[model samples]
Target: MAVELIILGVLALTAASLWIPYIVGVNTAPDGSIPADAPDGFIIPPDPNVHRPWVRRAYRAHLNLLEQSVPFAILVLLVDRVDGFSALTLWASIAFLILRIAHAVGYITGTARFPGRPLIFTGGWICCLLMAWAFFAA
Candidate 1:
């Protein structure tokens, strides 16, 4: 349970940090204003047409993290309730968190095309799989 809570805290922080690139990108426009043709009173509407590679990458990564996190949180809680924490569960939880951080960094830095991002993502999945196996095997 302690390890799960720690991972939750880390995930929350990771989600929060994803906003940095988006906020900076939004404010980068001239005078921090939307396009002249944009509807009035529209604040911070996401423009899918954003051309900046880093900003796009950050947004995609943020969404991806969110998608993965929901299931991860559910699985962690289930494991905590059903199997209780053992060495395998604790270590798997830690590994998942670490891999998530690495994946986010690789995504933001545009290095996802190489080995770092994909490998990190795969490692996270493996951790999740281990946790699931622990639940069933117990």
Candidate 2:
């Protein structure tokens, strides 16, 4: 139960669950989020533009989280497997979860603005790099 592993689990679960909001937004959109002629049972990428503001933000937030989580998860797991853990990994894990949560909330709520959102994203990306670095720095 290392800190990084716990944080990785939480991030993975959050990413896994993000589809619900985006899908709900897609299906409930007033503008008909999907093309009516699209085939059933096939995965269709949801268009955020068709949604209302918050819903559009939700879709974008979910996608952004997924994009960030992949590299974070991979780096954390690789570190755990190859180098055990360290203060760097621990702090990175904690900071990353916080940044990601803030980024997701801010983006979804439309509060993300100016340099704020990008800074948060860059912080999380730095955390991922830190995790990768921990594998060697340990």
Specify the highest-lDDT model's number. 2
Write the residue-wise lDDT of candidate 2 on 70-121 in tens digits: 9889888888888659887899999999999999889887898869999999
Clashing pairs in 1: none
Off by over 4 Å in 1: 30-34, 39-49
C-alpha local distance difference test of each model = 0.74, 0.81
In model 1, what lDDT does residue 66 have? 80
TM-score of each: 0.80, 0.84
Enumerate clash totals for all models, in the order shown: 0, 0
TM-score of 2: 0.84
lDDT of 1 by residue, 1-138 (tens): 387768877897887788787667666855534666675333344555533667667777787788777777777788777756688888888888888877777787887676767788788888878878877877
In the predicted model 2, the residue pairs found to clash are none
